[model samples]
Target: MTTTAPPEHPPAGSAPGSAAGRLWRAGRAPAAVIGLLVAVSVLLSLGSEQFPSGHLEPGSPEPDGARALVRLLDEDSDLTVARTSEAAVRAVERSGEDTVLVVLLDHRLLPEELDTLAGLGSDTVLVRPSLRSLAAFAPGADMTGRVDDERTLEPGCALPAAASAGDAGVTGELYTAGNGVEALGCYPAADGSGLLQVAAPDGSTTTVLGTGDPLTNRELDSAGNAALALNLLSAEDVVWLRPDVPEEVGSATLWELVPAGVRWSLAPLALTLLLFALWRGRRMGALVPESLPALVRASETTEGRAGLYQSRKARDRAASALRNGFLERSVPKLGLRTDSGPDSVVAAAAARSGEDPQDLWRLLYPSQPDPYTADDEAMLRLADELDRLSGRLR
Candidate 1:
């Protein structure tokens, strides 16, 4: 008669060599690619400066850059116009009293740097300056809010530049000067200030225009943008302080940079990951217990019993089982009858196992038969004794 053999399976560690295995392997590339894409997107969104520079760069031809305005200043007037961001006093001084420093960088400059620029001999014009920038360069000049005016705002103030510029797109951060501060606030929003001008004690002027639309290439032709931009920037000399992106002044951790909502959400994510790991690692089926025949090899039986005992932490039961099995084999080997008393079995086992007779007697015939107390070390010693006794007979 012909018989069929059982199907083979992959070993514990070996990857399966089948159609399913091939599919799994094939899926890995796409999975890795997707994960990498997600990681890159997250990094870009989190760190603002992670992307390339040139937001308002003068040299850049991008829509946001001041290249057109720089070119206009270079070509339109016969005055010296330098398209540079470096804080060089010598360049400004060389242009003499007619030098005008038009700072296009909005929020990049540090407080000290703005202060230094304000103190220069040249007339300064800061376009869309930050609060910190306002504090440093234009003292008493604080941004009020957004412009509420729907139409183009006129230069209502006495400043000649604003007056000549007429109605321009002054529809952004509104400014207000504090009391006793000798400054002219033109292009009046709902409140006092829009285009602020502070005359320094040394006669050098510091002008803070609320919007950059007047100078940008796209908006330069709009309303009186050209007129305003030229009036503000076209002195005998113009120093465009387009500062480089500044380094983070203070060191901060990744956790500190993360938003509060994102940080708070991580706890639930960690818990979900833990649950997923547990679910993935859990055993699929229940264990099936097996009983071996009495005629099984002594070592194999002993190893099987040891595994069971260890799983259940039944040290005492394991020790007793080991001793009983040894006695059953040894009594017959030493010529003692199967139904022999405990003393005789112990004496015979001790002689063969090379252990003390009294010690064997106590271990074999303990106070309790079913339940007894034995630690791991005692169980090990008992198993070793049985092995030695069985070996001697062989």
Candidate 2:
């Protein structure tokens, strides 16, 4: 009987005109768009006041309590107003000559910051609303005011020197800026030259001014407190320091400082793109035509062969095919399985082939069929016999 081969099916990825191919062709546009969007957003944000930059206007007034003090100093004093924060204080101290260190403390001062201010040696002023009475009266004593008095000052008011009477260790004069709205505390140095601590009657200390708002532009115009603010900060070149809150500092540059995990992810992405580029541009071979034969169906051919085998009861033939298949598969594994068969066949073959009988027996009928348990001796003998038999057959 004459038989013809069926048509060849193309490999899954062989069609260069497939959807995957289209995607491969069109992928660059979206990537370019995304890159452009990111670039634009960064540029626009950099142009806005929200994005912090060194070249922009100094002492941009934020809508907070500090703005009052900021405006007051900017409008009234010869001092150049430069906004700063606690973190940048050292830089300001270093660069600023005759700089006024305004601590808008609306609460008690941290020990370290207090120590830092105490050591400044230059003139420093602590301004707020609640602590004015303290600076006006008590110069070095602790606050003797009640907690209710402390609470009476608005959310950003300085603490009173009287309230901190027992706790006052810093040596500075505390002065009041406004009635309950604002205050200032001045702490003088040992020679009575450098301003140290200022307290408000509302029971807030000079440290509180660093936190409260009488110094900000928003409230400096309200209740005639601007004069008081200018008077307090006017002695030196005004540096308007705005310390960034911890959360703001943390979220500030989020995208620029990519972490290690992101960097590793980008590496794999870059490699994948490189591989894709290599695959797309390199021409493999020419496409070949495939034609189907009209004679036979695959299913019919398989069923007919099975029926013929069954009708003939070709057990020996089937076994021979299985043995041949096994031999073909196993022989290449170190030229092994050449001596595989029943013992008599193995012995007859070994003798006829000049191979060891004992070794042939081990290959033909392994005592332990398990690969894990097969002994080294059996493996070695079988390998030697198989090699000899394979050489003879070849």
Candidate 3:
């Protein structure tokens, strides 16, 4: 079919406001929008200081830090606060009963460290003990669950520490004191206990407090928190053990690092992405009729037919058509009848072309032993010989 030629493209730099320039201009809006969004985020982060920093760190001045409590122990009280676990252990070792080893950040401590701290001759206070640390240090005390409320509660049990503190912020993990150990359960939870004081065989006390919130700088002044912290930390020397993240725990598996909620949340996001891909990747527009060349030459059609015949291996059909076409065209030129037999046609062709009659007969028709089988090679040979004889007739 007839087709119009496409319009020629303009030379490079011909038009300053071409499609390329327009495309470049189009990207600026999105880039500026992204930059603005980033700037806004940075400004918001700089403006707000809602969350506390350096959780439970003695040296930190942030609200969440235990700097106030450390200062209280260092200045107001006579107890000298030893910072690291190594220093605390050494101080406890040197002073013996004179030193009080107060364990903070118990979750970071190793089992061996917990054992060492638990077996100390001096009184030890464990703040925010993980289940593993609690089980290792205080055998009978088991964490039940977490407390929803962070409000102060009355000291229900008769432990001297609790009784003296009166109402205290013991709102964290609730625990239960088993019958095997000589332990006092304090700050009674609905189901179990919030605090446990176990008398170790080494003549030293192991106090398990549920949370470290009450001991932090922010909550230290709230509801008998100062009184409770002071009473618990009252000693000649204080060894504050801030346990570092253990090597074994630090090498936790990928699954352990991802929280359950975050893992669950990924499922929906993944499904959404999958659905988006399917939607965007699908075939979009409807089918349109394509224009073809207006005219196909006779020679091209003949070559195309031959190609189709060769591809389909239609040797018999091709041979028959070739022979019929040759005979129909050459019969008039050779002065032979249209109804002439194969022998007559071969004799006429041989006489005109000066070829042997036997060869012409063989080319015209298959012999008794080997009838026309329509093999591709045999068909081609016959067609070529026929063309040579037909040339003689012309």
Best by lDDT: 3
lDDT of 3 by residue, 202-312 (tens): 777778888888888889999988888888888877877775554664678889876555555555555555765675578888988988869789999999999999899
Q: How well is each residue in 1-394 modelled by candidate 1, as lDDT tens digits? A: 9999989976644567666678778667656655665565555455552222364556656666667777878785434434333444546766667778777664666566666666675788888888887787777878887875546887898888889989988788788888887899888878655688987777877788877766665677789878888888766667776666555767778889886545555555555557657756889999989886556789997789778989999877667667777767767778989898887777766666677776655656766542334467666666675586578765
lDDT ranking, high to low: 3, 1, 2
Model 2, position 274: C-alpha lDDT score:
77
Q: Model 1, 166: alpha-carbon shift in Å?
A: 1.3
Write candidate 2's Cα lDDT for 172-276 as tens digits.
Answer: 233223434333333322232112244435343343222233334444454434444454455546544433333445665766676434544464456556766
Provide the overall lDDT of each model, using Cα atoms, as 2-decimal numbers. 0.71, 0.45, 0.75
Worst window of 10 by summed lDDT in candidate 1: 44-53
Using all chains and alpha carbons, the TM-scores for the candidates as numbered come to: 0.47, 0.35, 0.48
List residue ranges in candidate 3 displaced over 4 A. Answer: 1-53, 76-84, 245-394
Q: By lDDT, is 1 or 3 better?
A: 3
